[model samples]
Target chain A: MAAESHPGYGMRSHRSTLLRRLLRYVLLVATALVVAFPIYITVVNALLTPQQIAARPPTLFPLHPHWGAFASAFSTGHLGIFLRNSLIVTVTITLAELVTSALAGYAFAFVRFPFRRTVFFLCIATLMIPMEVTLVPNRETIVALGWFNSFPALIVPFLASGFGTFLFRQAFLGMPGDLRDAAALDGYGHWRFMTRVVLPMNRPVIGAFAVFAFLSAWNQYLWPLVVTETNGVRTVQIGLRQLQALSIDQTNIIFAGTVLAALPIFVILVVFQKQLVRGLTAGALKG
Target chain B: MSDTRRRRRLGEAALGYVFVLPALAVFGVFVFYPLVKTFVLGFYRTPPFPNLPSHFVGLSQYGSVLTSPAFLDSLWRTVLFVLFTVPLGIALGVALALLAHQRLAGIRIFRTIFSSTVATSVAVASVIFYTLLNPEVGLLSYWLGGRGGAGILQSPTLALPAVSVVTIWQNLGFVFILMSAALQSIPDDLMDAARVDGSSMWYRFWHVTLPLLSPTVFFAVVVGTIGSFQAFGQIDLLTQGGPNNHTDVLIYSLYQQAFVFNNTGVAAVMSVLLFAILLLLTAVQFRFFERRVFYGR
Candidate 1:
């Protein structure tokens, strides 16, 4: 706007505009490089020999690419076991969270209730408490129930996320109330209305949430680390951390393992980033 | 106000609780119950699993944690880590949102690129970063500092900040996304009017944009501060609070005591401390957000 003003202002504005444009280009490229280089480095190192990796001023691009590290990491470190455990944990958690939170969100948004606000607020209150507060108590309960080192310990506790419930509830609230009334008048019961009328409309939000819940379960480290001491139950994060300990000098294998671990999540984000951003703002930023 | 309508409302209320039932039950069992048990454990001398040695020794774990050098070091480092990341994160988030708000072409690619990290787990990310930041292997160290040998993660003095930078970088996307949405919702008329009144861009941002977007910023800050306080994965993977426990955060200390050394009681005390801090911050967030937030719509 200023660039279209008076001569002096216009000249100054033009200079600044060019400067800002240059700055933006510089920053975008730089930030992207920063975001991508770690992945790139891991990929490169995964294909390089250990001695090549240890070389001072290591090769910017791997001179001769090899896949020995990847092969070894997969076979030796029980990465296969970790991947299976991760897939089972993440998939089960995602499905459970989606169903539980969706039903809960629907009831909160549409169903008539006396203490509705109180219940919703209490759920919201849970969001404020840092996960740290509950860490020890949860372990104690796990120990008490003899649920330690079990999948149920991982699955049951996080079945319905407060964040996911809020997202679905907000989406459900945005829908017209008349849709439900129309369904009811057509002889649809509550469950039928929810399934036939409400749920189909809420797919995008649910898709978004499924992505989020999966990410949460996938990225979740402390809970998995704390709860599952056995190798059979550990998540990829634990698997990767173990690699850190195992690889002291030759980091090529660790890098390969890291890349393998991050690949699935990276692909998902590249595809679903828009929905993820929208879903995040809708639930977290909005009142 | 009719009887039938009142009954319907009552039914709805019951349904609300029912809908939220699974959440409350899980949260109670997994979150609250565990939290209380941890607090109680903090006060007691831990017995052998089936009860060979146990007692209700109040405040002793707290005393021991306070006296122990490791706990103090961890607490201090966590505070420092918190100090650098929270304000810096908010600032970066706000700035990115501002940048993204420009009516420039091809900006969505930048947005997507930044947001890409959100899907990444700490394990994967840490592993990726640990290699990229390896003093010998990393590309960044050279441009950042000459010789670039013994980079930030390796130095005890620099380890926390290095970890903080990665966290800030990783989290910047979500904050930017949230704040950009908030900024976008602000009407163009307001900006035009301010410009007609000859307000500078800085004035427009400070006087107009910030007030309208404070709620989003506040939300970001609260989440950021709480997150920074509870950060564990980065330190564990990258630094291990090593080179003399320079970067050991509170959560890592808790993990060490609880799992590594089996000082469950001391770990429990520190968890309560972290919980208390979180509770205080949450209360403060509600107060600030309530008073300062502007609902433009």
Candidate 2:
């Protein structure tokens, strides 16, 4: 409305608009390059020969690419074992979290139980307690259970999550009430209706949550670092750190291990980024 | 209430308990139990051997941990780390979000690129940064006149900041994604109204957009501060809390006290302290920042 009185105020000439667009493109491109610089340099160094990486100026691009670095790093660093360990841990956690969260979420959403509200609140309250605070006691518990330096130690502590329960509860609550009522008319009980109908309907939320849980498990460093001492059960993240420490002089080999460590997660992320975005935004909204 | 109605109600309650039992079991053993155990363990000096019994030391462990110079320095450094990362991460995220909010060709590509670092784990990022700042073979160090090839991570004064840089970079994608979502939710009609009223760009942002964005920004700050406090991998891979313990944060200090030095009782006290700090900060945010948030719909 105010533009009628001062037409030129908020309006720009076509020429100036074009100039602004150009400047914006330049800025965007520059920022993108800077943001991507670390990945770029790491990849380039991973593919370069040791002598090339050790050059005084440090080769910006690999003039003669050496792909063998990956194979050797995989063999010498036991990266294959690490990757398998990570996959087993991440998949187990994802499946376990999904099942537990879905069950608890269904209870909160549909079932009429005594102390339901209290139980839900207590579960949610666990989010406030950082895992670091429980590290010592958890280690002692694992040792006592005779599960130290094993998959149980690595996976058991994180088998369930409060946040996942909250997310799934919200998802179940969002489902249409009539759907459940109709299923009830067909002699379907809680478990039958949940598995047959409700779970299928909330695939997107479950998928998104699964991706998130997987990412967190895959990227987990501290817990695995503390729990697993032997290379037999070590994760790729810890393996990379150990590789770096051992291969200090072999920069190219270390870079290769780093690339290997990051590659699977990077690919998974790009493929599931939409789910990730939705999951993250959903979290922000609830918070 | 008829007999059938009572029977149905009892069955429903039983089903609810059955459904929630597994999760409750995990939370009991791993979360709540450990929390209570840590508090109890703070009073006992446990030897390094698994078979050795922990003797009750009353409050001696807590006293020592609180009075120790190392713990005090780590506490200060943790505060500084939070201060360093949270504001800068939010600001950088906001800037990138605003920059990429334009309606233009290939804008999605730029958005994706800005958020790419979210995929890199802390270890991956730290390793990349270590090589980049390696002084002897690093490209950035070469550019910075490497002082006979010595990297930034080597200096005691720059160690914390160096680790902070890695932390900021690692968090940039997460913050950008969050802020961009918040910014996109701002209505176009409101912006048009502000512009038609002859308000400048900065004026519209400060008075209109920012007020609406306060909630998301506050969320980012809270999450970022908690994360920065718990940061371990970067410090471990980059500086190892070193160059004279300059980069030692609360979580890293707890790690050292527990595993490295086998001082379990002291570590328990520190964990309790860390837990208290997180609770206090979260409470403060909810009390103060929640008031400023604009829930316009």
Candidate 3:
């Protein structure tokens, strides 16, 4: 009788646990739906025509889907050109930051120099000077250098990053000291050691900073909006703004442009999810 | 042998400087020079004509710009924006993190959904919200009674709050990621022990979870404060500091003064003031909140 009663109690607890799990799943799915609602709506509207978009109570789904808006966004809206410019600018900035940061980080970690502490301090101090404080003067410099409406205007100011330098420095400092000693014993100098040993060993950190640099450069708006005057150098962010301003009435076209602009970032986020998360959390968690 | 070693050491040190020069040059030309220029420009007033040279006003411009009604109003608006976005963002982030922190199957997909907004640029986010809040045909506008006549973005009183909603939504993913990472760092043993103590879920959350999550929460507060203070994209894209300048935060006002009105001196003053405010806020947060944050080591 005791054993039978114990089994009944166990079954009841199991049932309750299962019910609780079901409830948790329901909450998760519901929240996910809510969070993704805007993106979903944007995509749906992107696929619909203006008439369908203006229908009363709104169209939640694309009953008559079409890709004409995307084609128009690329051709007439010049999103294709903007996207190309953004790619060149983002890639250049990312690669430049990685190279500069890696070199600087390596120096700070392993080499000895005069005013080493002072120079390192100066590099990191740029982090405190918010970009807004420097915007007016940077724009002035850009105009003075004849870089207005040019790739240099968009890319030059962002080629080096204090955050990236700090990240790489931390990563290098965390490496085992004997590895460097071992490399040195083999007659490997700083460049060789960095290229062959340090760079190969710190792939994760390098990848993390790359993801970070790419994201920031791609997302830049204020500077690009201020500097670029034509489609030749305008980035996708600025292109989206122009599209919206020019075609405010055409909701589908604007939505299509937005999707086009955000598509690459989405792909990057999914493909480099681990590194991106690591890079983002690096700032909050480490400090 | 010792002399050669000393010479080699000097050579290595010089090489180190070579490695660091490129980065330093970039920072010096772009960051440091511009910072000093902003300060200098703040002291000089630009004439009405483009070709006319700026005159040195020497601290008077600072005095006037800092005390002007426009500056004060914009400052207030910026403060309001910060207040509206930061705490609420952090709260929502924590809630989302807690919800997705479960060990259930296929939870990774939900976590991805929760953190998805981090992928949206400020421009993309502003556009999304702009469409959703459009007066004539916006779904959100229709549902929320903002349709037909001057939707939320066009309403003077509702405009700032509407912009804030977008800011909060855009930043939600970042805060969520931070809190989620912090949550994962917390050990299971601590939570299991709390459960074993027969404490209610609420008690465990308050006493066990929240305290451990304080540092990241504090980090998010600092980051969110700085980000919110400098918010310009959404303002530029959505309202253009419109509805009678209701949403004209400091950054937008500064942009207008510098670019639109060509008031470099005034804009530079605003920039310096912004820098000072951020510095003070950061220092204060570090001093005050650093003590309260539990390391949990």
In what order do the candidates fall by TM-score, top score first?
3, 2, 1
Lowest summed lDDT across 10 adjacent residues in model 1 chain B is found at B141-150
Query: Residue by residue across A167-222, what tens digits does model 1's lDDT show?
Result: 78888899986888788789986678889878999888888788878877888888
lDDT of each: 0.76, 0.87, 0.89
**lDDT, residue A50, model 2:** 75
Give a tens-digit lDDT track for model 3, residues B1-297.
Answer: 699999998999999989899899999999999999999999998888889988998999999998899899999999999999999989999999988887677878888899988888999999988887777767788778644434789888899988998999888887888888888877766777787787888998899999999988988999899999999999999999998999999999999999999989889999999999999999999999999988778
Q: For residues A1-287, could you state the per-residue lDDT of candidate 2 as single tens digits?
A: 12011112345898998898899899999999998899888899889887788787668878778898888788877889999999999899999999999999999999999999999999999999989999999998999999989999988888888999999998999887798889999999998999999899999899889888988899999999998899899999999888877544578888888888888877876898878876666677542
Q: How much is B131 displaced in model 3, in angstroms?
A: 1.6
C-alpha positional error of residue A92 in candidate 2 after TM-score superposition, expressed in Å: 0.9
Better of 1 and 3 by TM-score: 3
Candidate 3: stretches off by over 4 Å: A1-12, B1-3, B146-150
lDDT of 2 by residue, B6-110 (tens): 999999999999999999999999999999999999999977786899899988888988898989999999999888888998999999988888778798899
* Ten residues in sequence with the least summed lDDT for candidate 2 chain A: A1-10
Per-residue CA lDDT of model 3 for A1-287, tens digit only, reads: 01001001123478788998899899889988988888889999899988888888778878779889999888878998999999999999999999999999999999988898999999999988989999999999999999999999999998899998888999999999799889989999888999999999999989988998999999999999899899999999999888877555578888999999999989988999888888788877753
Models ranked on lDDT: 3, 2, 1
Q: Evaluate fnat for each of the predicted models and list the values in order.
A: 0.69, 0.69, 0.66
